[model samples]
Target: MTNKPKPVIGITSGDLNGIGIELIIKAFSDQRLLDFCTPVIFASNKVVNFYRKTVTESSFSFYHTREFDKINPKQVTIFNCWDEEVNITPGVLNETGGRYAVASLQAAIEAFKEKKIDGLVTAPLHKSNVQSESFSYTGHTPFLKDSFGAPDVVMMLCADNMRVALVTEHISVSAIAQHITAEAILSKLNIINSSLQKDFGISKPRIAVLGLNPHAGDEGLVGNEEQTIIAPAIKQAKNNGILAFGPYSADAFFARGQYEKFDAVLAMYHDQGLIPFKSLAVGEGVNFTAGLELVRTSPDHGVAFDIAGKDRADAGSFIQSIFFCADVINQRSEYADQRSNPMRKIAPDVVSRLADEKIEE
Candidate 1:
């Protein structure tokens, strides 16, 4: 059989002080990874070697390049972002590592903007230290939203089986109720629905939305948000021909496996969805930024400061992210093909009427 075209996946080496480089090196060590797609690391070769030497005795190497033209799809390529030598330390938080993380990320994003890479797989970044004068933002999600000029995007966490999205992310718990209006919920629901179809290749996806309050507001006894805001949003979603449901009690939804029935779930706040998703995902999930024109996924976990140089980081999620990006890109291509040359999927009633007319004729 002939080989299929592979997407060039650009990788941003996040926060050099952490396990970002370790995971990036370990994940790409396996030669079989190149069979799926090419990976280009956006970091200095010196930093990558520092992590490799600090953590391992192995001799894994990446071809260094000055520009995108030098990329080879069969092996690893390090797109040198930093010119001069920089301090490379493990498990130490400083401005140097933080600057490098954002530098690498920004370079990879520019590569993405130029269409040099198909998808991006970013390693973990320290939220506190990664802040720079030019890169001051809550996190990657908002920065990416502004970078791409997208009006809105969803912070979705995806695993093999479970997918959960947040309505309000990186915010205070007290601020959640204020943001959980009918409009916000409906907007998230719509984004989820669209991403499911276009990004995830789900046809008429079923989404379950979680409520803001305990027991989903207890029908106004516990709170009024669910009864007034959430339910109305669900109503609007259904009316818009979206397979949306819920105002489901967040506590009971996952307790009884109610999430298994749907393609995706929308939670009211950060912890409401993430706590359960993390507990259930068991360190195997991938944080995907849904509703963007490009595909981006990162290791679900964060910068493991304590275990930075231990060579103990698990590259499972990172590897899965690479494969998932490939799958999502393929799914998107197939979805576009189907849309452009849609299949004969007429409504059942319309088909019956046509059949009856033919018989009568």
Candidate 2:
């Protein structure tokens, strides 16, 4: 049998004024990454060269193409999205940056629809800068959900062994309590459990649920979200054959390193989970969107405008995101194959007969 072809990965060039392009160039500078997947960057040659000059000694090279059919698998492919003359001011926020960022994303989304790419690894884009009437959303998760028609998606942060999935993302803290319902929590738990099994190859994922309130509402004295909202969700998850346990105090849980005991942790809101994840991830974390047919991962850190053009951005997380995307693509394919033709156990008598037949042969 022959080996499978390398997966085609689509990468979006985020915020021209930020460090998105720099990170992409730095990550792909190492030719060794090409052995795993064929990378197709959705940006014009001009935009890439603007930052390529700033990376000190970047050896990144690419094949420029206007048609998807002409993508070269041997080297990186720069799928030119546009050919307009625009000023690129690094470390500055402007409409030009936002407009072109959207263009790149739309181009990548089109490629995804055509099935030209197996997975996506997006560079960070500023939430405020990318906001326009036509593309108004908090961040990539919701935008992607609408683009792909996925009912809902979970924002999961991954670093080594620790995985944290958020039930609520990019919402105001004042409104967080209102959204933490039993149904919502249960939905996130289901997605995390399924992603762990299918994407991460966990046969039975053990999920730890974090509470919305401090000290887990102190058993209902500080708040009742744990008892009323979170507890019911955990109970229902267990009933549904998911081994989910929690309503654990967010402080004590991380303070004691309890996240290592489970496959994934479900946090009630954004900062509640991300703060701890970023602190512990030590620049090795990446953001993965679960509960979608398409696989998407991004660098855990955002567009660092302060350090933009300084060549100070670390590409570790960006590189890891690519690795994560490829791993998930391969895992999902293997999962589909196994489910399509599962192995059957032979009975004792059948095994004996098969053994005797083999011996006679």
Candidate 3:
């Protein structure tokens, strides 16, 4: 039904010991998925074979590509990120896992820079182990932000039922207040609104902005952030032609089920949005990096070291992540074309003339 060219999705295998490879293997086992998009995994052949022999139940075909021109569209292919000798441990956390994780990601990023790949889907990596001189940020979002020199970015957690973005992520709770300035809030809103329009193909997005304190700050009794910073930013965003709303109290907002009415929700901090999001849609949620020039997504869950080799880690989120990336790529392509030649608005007289012409025909 779709005539669009298949996007080559670049997947970065996360911590070698984690369930990242297992998730990738399980998701790609079905050949029919190839009809949707081409997958080019950035990993070593030995590491993949180890996973196939150890964890997976069925065979997954992969072509080892010496060059991007050799990548096959019908079959999954390994991009040959590194040729270094390595050992595969299922459940242990070590420095080696981080090293390859970085290697795979850097190779994919280079390809993305060169326009060899359409988008990226990253597997889970442990926060502590994935550190390097090149990647010192907390997680995937900041690293991508800095790598591309993006001024700022939004970490949006999206599922079938809900879409929530954070104003702040991976920052200390005590320091959250200091960062909740009007500028930060407004910038995030701009990102969320723009992403909802271009990335997700939403025409007019209605966003809900949640409060930082309890009980909507009880009219400044609980916290002054709602009055001093959050509200002013919402006003500024609305003035800028964004359909943004709220300073909504998180408790009543979710408990009363008010989120169902909006296109997206913006939270003040990490736990404020993620706690409820995970509870409602953990296995289905996809972590999307909004406001970046390049498209990237990941499974909402982290490196589950406990279930590394147990074959218990669910591939649902990762599968969704791939499909989401594909959809975004298609939408972004259309968005670019539309932006270049935007639709001309029809006036009342033009509409009447068109109706008259149709009647005459």
Candidate 4:
């Protein structure tokens, strides 16, 4: 019998000046993480070392590699981009750090394309500091989408069991009204539905779509967007057998524990979804990019410039992101393996029957 290969998770260190390196070091230091997947950090050795010394006490050694063949699971592996030289200060942002950050992300994307890694988890990066004019695409979601030729992508933030997906991300509040359309909402719903089923192992996913206006337009008294745009999209998605329903008022819905009823909630804009989500799961939230050929997730928070070098950055979100990536990869592998073996189908039924029999006793 051949042993299955362990899933390799590629992690990109975001901005050198921020807490990206610190969180990366703290996350990898947890020996418990190695039980699930092999983690490979796509970064430079000097940057990692500098953060370790400045932020926390270092115990583990990082094996620096220029090629995939040099990766070793027993040691924390660092894939050196060798992109450029930068004197990485703990709390100051620099163009050199930005350039290296972009290079690290590009290297990870190439590794994913080459089938060297199963999924990718990224740290936060500064948009203002990166060197290339062409890299002006907000955050990692758009960058990854354009890199892989995926025209449509959705950003979902997961906090424990509850999940919220954004229909429009990284756009201004003024532009959101123009961007909200039936096609756009339907596309995001499809991506969320498919992702919950395939990646999350949810057999039948239930999605809730939030309204564009307060009180869901109060029957068109407050705003007509819920009637003219959102309701039509929800109806369309349901007609296509997506199990989608909503146009629910954003304020009252979350306050009433309505989010627990669905597997994922689709918000019309960025802050409309994220504000409540972060309030509920601030330190533990993990941001996941859906609708990509490859899986990508990140810590939901940004660079804490105030306490960047103070050793006060919490690694909870970063740790959760790694575990979430591992869980998704495992589910995908398990589903594929079951499809290859017909006998595995009966295992669930057999277990169910045994449980029923025991209940009668």
Candidate 5:
């Protein structure tokens, strides 16, 4: 029997001015990463070399090529998206950084379209800098949702066994409550439940839904959204055969380490979930876009402009993102394979006859 081919993971060089390149170079320096998946960085050799100079300690080199067929599985390959000369500026955000960042991402998307990559691991990108008439989505999740025609997607932050999914992300605080209808919560619940099973391989995922108000509305004294909106959503989720529970008070639940008991937690908003996760996960957290056809993951931290060129940025999260992408890709493939030819159900009469034969014997 032959061994299965490794997954081709596409890595986008996000924001040349940021620490994304540093993290990428640092993560691949170990070389053992190439054994799990073939890494294809969607950036030019010149751009990668610019940051490679800062991380002089790492002896990471890449196979520079513009063609897809030239990608080396055993080595890192830089898929040059552009050939023109561009100025490099660390710790500064500019239009050029955003422009090239978009170029790298679009190139990776094209590779996905051609079925060249199995999964994608993106570096951090400044949301404001990348905004234009063509790309107007808040972050990668929305852009990918539109690109793939996904009806809905969940921005899931994962670290170790702890997973937190948000119902609303990158929106104003005032607008969060208005968006927290039962339908929206139930939709997120379904997506989170499905992802836990298919992406993470949880057989029966138990989802803990957090409340929208303090003390879960304290029996509707502080706010009624928990009782009126969130509770109803959890009920509807259970009706749909989802093991969903609670409009639990977010603060107390996390303080008491209640999340450890459940498979996943569904936060009402972005910060409500991320604050605790970032605090707990620190440098090892990974942001996974759940409910997408393609597997995409990113480091939980953003572009650290302060430490961009100082070589102080840790590659733990970025490396974790790579491993997470491979795990999800394999999990999805295995899950699909198991479902492809399911065992036929035994007929009632056949079962009864077998039972009677056993009894007679």
Candidate 6:
């Protein structure tokens, strides 16, 4: 029997007080999105309806489905997880909203694990609220990694055609120095390389590694981490036959569109990469969790509590998340097809696979 077209995407409604509902409403408003993949929202009909009334009374219709088999892409399909009545108050954080948001995420994750959904495109969830309601985790990336038992996971934020992968995430600036070791850097680089080749379809991805210090430690004049830690990691990555280069200065590297030269940049810290990345591609950036067992993507921006219900939230990033998810899904499908095809022959030494010894030792 032929396999059915499984392009169903699960979208988790973020915090009720945030722009999650607004963006979801706006993104699905476009009928063209249905042409690419079937979107299954893991939310409540009551919540979505109330959001529509508060934000845009466009008279759009949504079909409620309890199961994935009942999804119809031609119309908006919502999986009702909440059986009780919900009060949809935009721009207000409450216990009910927090619980509901966590429920939606859990439902989507279960569906993905069951193979009912092809990929997941999360809206935005308030970290504090989610932690209070559900199990405490670092962020979406770590949550997904733990959920799927993915050993190595990378958080990549992309905007304006520039992509950056975070080496150390969800930690303070002072803690980043201790976290920046040669082993950690090399491991992240491996994840980035595999993700680019498999999910991104980049045959030979040239990746740039950013230095942790100013002016790349001025060649050890300022700090020796560049020479001792970062440089050695890059050298090891190069020896592994990965096209990895540099420990470029974080400040001057982004100027003159230098980031465009490489496929992706490995940032040593969170703000060091995200500040410039967001500055260039704030509303349009898509935050992608690479090296996951399943495809997962989200809007680069966070919950905009200030303008949640004002109809002022831009859906650009949310829309970009959907598009990026679709793109990655297609890339993965194509790669799988190529691998299964008998006529296709992959080069033996093209991409080096890291052994257990390399990863552990």
TM-score of each: 0.93, 0.94, 0.94, 0.95, 0.94, 0.91
Evaluate candidate 3 by giving its C-alpha RMSD to the native, one decimal.
3.4
Which residue pairs come into collision in candidate 4? none
Model 5 root mean square deviation, Cα atoms: 4.9
lDDT of 6 by residue, 1-361 (tens): 2544648899998777788878888888887888888899899888887778766545456799797778886877899988788777677777666777788888999999898888999888777767762558766788888888987789999876789999998997778899999999999999999889888888899999999889999988999999999999999999999999999999899986889899999999999999999998856999999988789999988778888888788889899899889889988887887779724435422323445447777
Please give the RMSD to the true structure for each candidate, in Å: 4.9, 3.9, 3.4, 1.9, 4.9, 7.7
Candidate 2, lDDT over the whole model: 0.91
- Between 1 and 5, whose lDDT is larger? 5
Tens digit of per-residue lDDT, candidate 5, span 1-361: 2466889999999998999999999999999998899999999999999889899689798899989998889999999999999998999999988888889999998899899999999998999899998889788999999989999999999998599999999999989999999999999999999999999888899999999998999999999998888998899899999999998999999999999999999999999999999998877999999988899999998989889988999999999999999999988887886677443223545778999999999
Cα lDDT for residue 64, model 3? 86
User: Which regions of candidate 5 fall more than 4 Å away from where they truly are?
Assistant: 343-361
> On a 0 to 100 scale, what is the lDDT of residue 331 in model 6?
86
Tens-place lDDT digits, model 4, residues 186-299: 999999998897789887899999999888899999999999989999999989989998899999989998999999999989998989999999679999998998888999
Q: How close is candidate 2 to the true structure, as a TM-score?
A: 0.94
Q: Which residue pairs does candidate 3 place in steric collision?
A: none
Q: What is the C-alpha local distance difference test score of each model?
A: 0.87, 0.91, 0.90, 0.87, 0.92, 0.85
Q: Write the per-residue lDDT of candidate 1 for residues 112-195, one digit (tens) a residue.
A: 889999999988887888776798887889989999998788999999779999999998877778888888788888889999
**TM-score, candidate number 6:** 0.91
| Candidate 5, residue 73: lDDT | 90
Worst 10 residues of 3 by lDDT: 340-349
- The model with the greater lDDT, 4 or 5, is 5
lDDT of model 1 at position 260: 92
Residue 176, model 5, lDDT: 95
